[model samples]
Target chain A: MTNRILYVLALSAGLAVGPAAAETPVTIGMITTLSTKAGYLGEDIRDGFQLAIDQGGGKLGGVPVELVVDDDGRKPEKGKQIAERFIKHDKVKILTGIVFSNVAMAVVPKVVREGVFYISPNAGPSRLAGKGCDENYFNVAWQNDNLHEVVGQYVNDKGFKNVYLLAPNYPAGKDALAGFKRFYKGKIAGEVYTKLGQSDYAAELATLRAAKPDAVFFFLPGGMGINFLKQYAQAGLNETIPVFGPAFSFDERLLKAVGGAAVGVRNGSQWSHDLDNPANKAFVDAFRKVYDRTPTLYASQGYDAAHLIGSALAATGGSLSDMDAFRAALERADFDSVRGKFRFGPNHHPIQDLYIREVIETPEGTITNRIEAKVFTDHADAYASECQM
Target chain B: MLLILEQLMNGLQLGVMLFLMSAGLTLVFGIMQVINLAHGSFYMVGAYTAATVTQLTGSFLLGLLAALPAAAAVGMLVEAVVLRRLYSRDHLDQVLATFGLILFFNELTRMIWGRQPLFMDVPDWLSGTVELFPGAPYPSYRLAVIGMGILVAVFLYLLFTRTRLGMQIRAGASNREMIAALGVNIRFLYTLVFGLGAMLAGLAGVMAGPILAVEAGMGEEILILTFVVIVIGGIGSIRGALIAALLVGMVDTLGRVFLPGLFRLFLPVAEADGIGASLASMSVYILMAAILVWRPRGLFPAQI
Candidate 1:
């Protein structure tokens, strides 16, 4: 058939270009949600990964790397289809860049079984951190609950005894509240789980006003966060009480949308734009120059994923053969991570410090987070001990 | 009691916005016999135009002014180009074509505005909260919205009842062939009607730009609700739209606020929260179904 001939021709064309280059061509396939309400998050991750590859002079470990990007459509089934294609057709050994955990959980198990390595740029579902963790799976981002748990410690340390809790009614949302409750030694006056993407927060805000908590902790991400924060400020609640959240809520991308309303809000993250590190400075600078916008924590994760894979490829000489050698190389994590000094824990998730960042109106006339203090240092997930792998 | 009062105002504000949207959709469907699924595209277009104009001029009022004509022009242009041909086509064809327009508009807006949602500042005069009661303070902007919705509704009522164009539109809806046979300039009438409908949607979008996140695909989210409003209000009745929008708004807001508490009385907190939320989400559709079961043509059938 003509279709089969054309497919063979394209495959051979890709093969023909490899040998002419200095080294064997490496292909990495990126599958992430690129079209929906949360589409911007995936775009940020993809741009960050692309920026790292561009910085590497279009090579990973001194070899030309061909990156294939596919949109998951924010569906787990679509992610599975893309994963199967990347594994079986493209024959990519390294796979990364999943923005949502539910999609990652669906795709990771299937691809890992097929002997592909997945370095998650974002979304660390709990199941992948504990006994379900695989050697082939590495999460460059913090576990889903890590930052919220740190915020819990921060809230308790600030001596807030009464707090109102809110999150979307979903798995990550529950994990976020659970993480916040883990370390906060305070009475929750009220806990509300709003429908995901529920824009009008008037009813909930009115309820929160009635509860009259000293502070409020919410885990509404993306546009939901934008809507909530805007309404919060409009209601004059921001002036009376502090709002606490993870970095996802108060990130640079969202702060731009939420404007001055986001200023003075405190959030926790493993990476801050003001981190005093050479790699971070370079990544931030290069990202702004290329994208003409400030890169958020999601972008930082993507940049780290690229460098992590690059480090492994360099150690293995652009070859992932001798699976043990490659796994050991990745476990070393010797890359110059934009986050600085990153190393995998027993479950392949990062064992790193969580820093409290406060959104400040910077001298540059933009709102961005500044590193205020460290909440947890050399922190590892509680689930790592349960992972036999 | 104060909470209930404020929640009622919130419901009214939402109902007002939905009426702005549904009034236009019902009108277009009634007069043109064309299901304009791209109605939300007009909303997005209006918001973007307002945001951009506001940014350039630094005047919210001027931005609001520009949104009306800009959205109307865009709507008329679309009517003249794509929708004009599809008017005589089957309902399925019209739906498919208009659905394509939604995608085209969404992507085109993305190309122009980028992925980030645009932020518009409320005019300083409208930014403060007004005391509705001694203990309850409602947002002045939302109060302004309620006022605007009422004014628009009155204006629409007058236009339909008092104006020659309004009579033609009514006649066109009930008997298009007779209007055309009478040399009523049916082409001009359709374009004018669509442009007017588009302007109403634009007005809703402009007002909503400050409150809602003005981004791509926003039109689709609110469009579904608008369809529900029109369906419940009657497919072609303006008065029904106003009443049904208010009803849907109150039911949704109050259900979200009080349902969980009612459930908690019968069950534990967590289980009640889950059950309450699922039911609350279904409350609007259930209302629509109940209304239809009793009156299949909706509350007011727009008697010809």
Candidate 2:
């Protein structure tokens, strides 16, 4: 009778121990633009983040994590809805992976207010880096203007007297031009704000030609950049007036689409696949083996974000009961980044080196960006001073 | 003066492309009395097919040839399978069904081609710029597009006015029941018209592939403009479609070019630029509204 009672007690104890040892995976919600023309942006981020988690055997820093992903479709309202669902319905404490500034702006402010930690793999708007900074917010990506600012500085150094500027009429677009102007003190021949998602540029090109700038600087991301570069080349302006933009337009996949049109064009970036770092080499090789494609800056950002989160999770032993301890751990940012050196400012945005990369045709006859020079070393965002924190 | 000339040429090129897209959409709506939200999907299908074929064969002409038939076949299949069931249904139901088709085709392209935008380079012969005048250089490919648009317009005119199929199509558009009573296979006729419309959209897609990023959902970007063109031209009237497409295209292009400069004369440069860009995007829509107010049945309503 005593043996039977002891066996029942042992079985119940085993059940309790199994549940505790296994532990419910800490949930991380990712709302990203995984559809529309910008879908590839999110695909790279998700793939990179998944790679890190997969490396940890469905865990981050030896802590099991459940990642719930949903498509924002590049819509602000849709992103907000997904964030709400993740926060309330799923009871997720962590959020990440938004590709567009508008969607991030709409979703981040609200979620951070709800006491959920938001790690941005991409899309670091200036406002959030400034007065809107929150303890719960951290950006593994550079601020929206950082890459553009690097190009602006490079253009100024190149002795371009008059440069024409163009970007979509949106917050990020405005920030891009502002960032360029901060460094480029040359004469602005003309400035144009195009409609968001506009594919055609004939009319704009006509005026640009008339303006007679020595060079052109544009920030049309994704498919917009592809159309612009092709048309720019087709118009016979490429040979006369050089073109430059941030790395968003000159990503690996986009360069393939732009072909010879984008060759010789200079773009600013914070990370490259060929960065001379052990961590970067490992990442590039592993990513190519797993995904069978070159990783864009976005993929690098996602990988960094996952590792950053992993560092914090490791320090806290994956426990989030003490918010202060978790926040402090994240602020430490104890991870070896693929970008060579990376750390967060007081605003939780990245303070890192930026590089000027030139599009070149490899011996294999494929177009890709190669680092030409380091533009800035340990550069921080202009808005960092405004963050009281 | 050179800048103005170049801008005008740009406007003409844009108008020609719009005509190609609107002609097919107007025909389907005018004849079948069906609202097809998925008209753009056919454009996407054509582009994807052309891009794939061009990459494989290394010949733009072969890609164009393949895309036309492929798009037509897909359109015919969709019409016979899905659209046929929605013919007698309410306009709302047709809209819903065709909208579903848009999602279907967009996702289908993604599944097949992956998410990356495909490259479609301009044929070597059409890669350079042609000097229209001493100082005005234009892309040869765009010139070819204009020429192609004119050829299609002429061909469509001859097909509709001179061919027996054209008469049958026109009659069917006006009175489907009467045409059926007169021994015409109305269903087959409708299918042919849909195929023709899809082919024209396909042609637009193939031409646009060289200039634009040939990616999934590319159709929807220009689809709204196509709708505006058909609405302004009068539904089902090809002549009106031609005129309206050019008009809308010119307005859109010129507005984008000149509006900010005009506004700068009065307002601050910054405010003027912002307002001008916003206004330029709205110019076609505003023109459509004005046209609707003046001619509620459109510029040329079908009078049989």
Question: By DockQ, who's the top model here?
Answer: 2
Clashes of 1: 0
- Summarize candidate 2's per-residue lDDT along B45-153 as a digit string, tens digits: 9999999999999999999999999999999999999999988999999999999999999999999999999999999999999999887789999999999999999
State TM-scores per candidate: 0.95, 0.96
Among all windows of ten consecutive residues in candidate 1 chain A, which has the lowest summed lDDT? Answer: A16-25
Cα error, residue A113 of model 1, in Å, equals 0.4
Complex DockQ per candidate = 0.59, 0.87
User: A184, model 2: CA deviation in Å?
Assistant: 0.9
Native-referenced TM-scores of chain A, all candidate models: 0.94, 0.93
Clashing pairs in 2: none
Name the runs in model 2 displaced over 4 angstroms.
Answer: A1-23
What TM-score, to 2 decimals, does candidate 2 have?
A: 0.96
lDDT of 1 at B138: 72
Fnat, model by model in order, equals 0.46, 0.86
**Leading candidate by lDDT:** 2
